[model samples]
Target: MNDQPLDNLDGDRDHATAGSGHDGEDHLRAPAPRVDGYAPLRSYAAIGDGRTVALIAEDGRIDWYPTPDLHSPPAFAAVLDEEDGGQVDLAPVDEYRMRRAYVVGTNVLVTTFVTATGTVRVTDSLNTGVAGRLPWSELGRRVEGVEGEVSMAWRVAPGTMFGERSPWVEHSPHGPVLRAGCVTVAVPTLGEMTTVAQEQDISGVFTTSPGSRHLVGLAATHDEPVHVPVPEDVDAGIDRTIANWRVWSREFHYDGPWGKAVQRSALALKLLIQSATGSVAAAATTSLPESWAGGKNWDYRYSWHRDTAHTVDALFGFGLREETHAAISWTLRTLRNPDMQVFYELDGSEPRPPRELDLPGWRGVGPVVDGNPAARQLQLGVYGDVMGVVRTYVDHGHLLDAETARTLAALADAACDAWRRPDSGMWELPELRHYTTSKLGCWQALRCAAHLAEEGHLPASPDRWAAEAERIRAWVERECWSPELQAYVMYPGSDSLDTSILLHAHSGFDRTERMSTTIDALRRELGHGPHLYRYTGMREEEGAFVACGFWGVAALAQVGRTEEARQWMDELLETANDVGIWTEMIDPGTGEFLGNLPQALSHLALIEAATALGSGLEGR
Candidate 1:
């Protein structure tokens, strides 16, 4: 809320102050590596203010930021199109080696740059207001000199929405402002520096001496009067944001295996949870290709019922009532309509059909999609997703309203009827067939419904649900198990194996000798190194799905192979990027990131796997 109009922005903007010195040196004399002007996905770290996230590369470039909200159009998106996409660069002018990490317990990033002349530290954050989230978004960069004097250069450039709209700079009484579409941005500088205003950007250079501190603030708004933040207030907000994140992180109660990684995953999931609503975005970005040859890109900013359920379950493990309740309540309220889609918009509305945008995609992976087509598919697993979370909610000593109870009963009845039909399954494949995982999900749904009815939380007939669950069990056992392969196949008759079957271990569906044997078959067929391809033919097209590997950890623990699960967990934890962020997939051979980043499902799976190992409890 430290934003005011141009009339109030007149002041001596020199707000330099000496701050604590940073320790650590990662030295390299070479320039940052780039291929076609794009940094490697593994080279990026993230900082956010709960409303939206900004991806910052190790070299100090603010790339791939969506304004106002996570799903909104980008205000800075050099990660996608490099040339036309906007970016904010703050780094040493000369060649420097850099290393970065989240400031211990918070999302605020600290990157230390070591040059031949001296060293400097850049602390970056999307500032939060005093009360809570701010109405206007502010990107704060605090530069501190740790050693001898070093020269630094910065640029604040707003893009044309990848040629969708044009950006122009307007000179005002206070300074130069960049306007593109509905977004208006003001770059305010503090400390000893010189700045130049051009047609499209504001450029600057400054020299920092030992103990000198400087700040660069970008205050922006969409469809509203832009606020030019006071440099002093922006500096204070950065400290306040760090304290706030630390306070939130303290409430996370995990002491299991890979505790640091688990907490990082939880923080990453928090970034995807929109504070305005309780909806959880599947990932932070869209159109980051799953395949290098293009055509696999899809938007993940929407909320899927399955993901919400998983998020609720993971939050519940940490005893986080607010997030768990908000997610469940929002999902149940959004699903009041009889027909359920695969996913919904973040604001509890039905999503529009997928549309491909006109832009050179990330590294020229074309057909950058804006919405998702999977919303139209009939994924029967959503039934299990809903019922499972409701059961967990009730188990946690919470009550369901009368309307929700009735609606769930109806959904249970529908699941009974739908399990017999072939549907798109969890993967949302174009060719619908009798997917074994989808059938298992229906079986789980009926079982949970019967349990709820017995506990008096539901009004449905328990007998019918139990009978249907038994029938599903018999059908899956009879047709889905491939005797020759000694494993459960993808469908009734196909010989292909899918790693999604590992999810059944945590679903309370099967943990018998057969299920244990199936785990071995899956690892043998799909695993490469510490990762697993999603299904039979995914190795031919994409990298191994990151979440599937974590699912294996939970499956192994569930089947009583604790030693194997712990060893596997150790190896998988090492696969995360330096900042503990994970993409949708990882190339097993090259260790490169793929697909959308800071993926919620991958982090959620990590939490679940850790909980499974620590508690030694059967899947709920």
Candidate 2:
């Protein structure tokens, strides 16, 4: 993905000593100081060009970066293995402090580092091409002296993905090519001890004076047709990349409160979109544990229709019609049968079964598993989610083709027949049960389909769909509600409270009394200060689900608890990383981020909540 802030950064590669001099080529490893432990997951900022992402730590180390595509194996896996695959470092040689932010409305990350001597600003971006997505991936780092002189060192260390393949300097017509395994990177050879390759390493040390501009960049290829970008073109590519993001940002129509946060969330969600296929991934990284002393880690690189629908819905709210159409069209192509698969590869195929790893996870949490098995599970919520996008698309003055109409009709019938059966809920539980949210999803699906049918856009029997919706509603009210608990329970014949039920209020299902009571019941049962766990007894199984917390706020605002929602939102905003990126969950007590980052679902939920509270959609 050449063009989008396909963002975010980090690495851990075996060190290679730089072989001095380039008699046509040099192999070198500049000594990289070891960084032992991970900085808090909350300390990383996500930056991308739209095709790939890299997570930059607060201290100026790029801790994690998946190359070429979000679905590709990571080129930088330091965030996964600190001692083995660590980071590409660029910082002061002495004790230093730093500040970071996105450049206005764009995804270009500018981190300013201040040492005892002076300040040097690092501008990091995954450079996009001038027009469409880039033909290749490029990471552009420009260090400009903002104040007095400061000594800085920069190194290119291949991460664990390239442990057996440190960057080797080779002669190319384009100057010097750095090839490591299936990945090839081209960088400018200009610095003290320049163009040295040893143990397949390329690095340079330089000092910055006031007004001095030092640019270093990497052009990488992932088994694609390679067009090694020239150093001069690489510099121009950075300018164009920043310009492209700003140009895209102009289409955003959100003028609500938290405008910057909303835009940033939009930008992050933008990076997760698969430009070639038009699918949106759940998060940038997989296997970043969702809990400390982990047990719930799962690959989030694949696209979940449930999550993508939320993305599409939120993007539509921002007046980003292009994104909405792309996600809808791509997701529609993957629904082979009426029952929605929980997840799939960006190419609309089912993901392979998950495999376990023995490596230590972030913060010593082990059992990192990759490739999600959720693709095989029955997450009935996806029926409503997919139709929800269709609902919004029609609301925006677009007409669905006959194929989509047929799909909606089939889905309505599927929901009718399937709502009575037990299936995995949104959390993808293993055991089949009559989960309230699962039934509620089918209810919403039928209700949405019935609306389309009533409007004469679909061929479904509106009367039957309405009857089924009522039937599902009655079933949930009768079996899911717990008078003893004073709330809608997690599943039939259970008294456990579920935070997901908070969405029913927003969905206009059990609004007012039961929903408000559900909100109160869940808050008392599952709440932990500013955050809420996903279900009844998850206090220790995983971290706080940030999206559920925001969903709760939206429910509160919808129930006329505006001040309470505002108070909660104010606290949640503080949990965002320095560059305003968020993860899947949070450590409520320590405020540390838990799980994969630039989490699209969490950000989408944030937009939904803020828009609801700020625009009075909740109290409507």
Question: Which structure among the candidates has the greatest lDDT?
Answer: 1
Stretches > 4 Å off in candidate 2: 1-35, 162-176, 189-195, 337-340, 617-620
- Model 1 C-alpha lDDT per residue in residues 321-437, reported as the tens digit of each score: 888888888889877966788889998889988888888888888768889988989898999999998999999999999999999999999999999889998999999999999
Winning model by TM-score: 1
**Per-residue lDDT of model 2, residues 1-620, tens digit only:** 12232222111111111111111112111222334577777777787876788888767778777677777666677787776663577777877766566765677877767778887777888888767678777888888887898888777776656244444557777665666668776766333334454455566778888777777887778876567665667767777878888888898887666666667788888989988888888998878888777777888988888877788778888778777888888888887554457778888887877887655667667666778877877778877887777787887788988887897798889888988788878888888998899988989988989998998889866999999999998888888888888899999788888888887776789657778778888889888887899997799688999999889888988888888887777777766665678899998888878888889889888888788787564345
Q: Which 10-residue span in candidate 2 carries the lowest summed lDDT?
A: 11-20
Off by over 4 Å in 1: 1-32, 617-620
Instruction: Pick out the ten consecutive residues of candidate 1 with the lowest summed lDDT.
Output: 1-10
RMSD of 2: 8.0
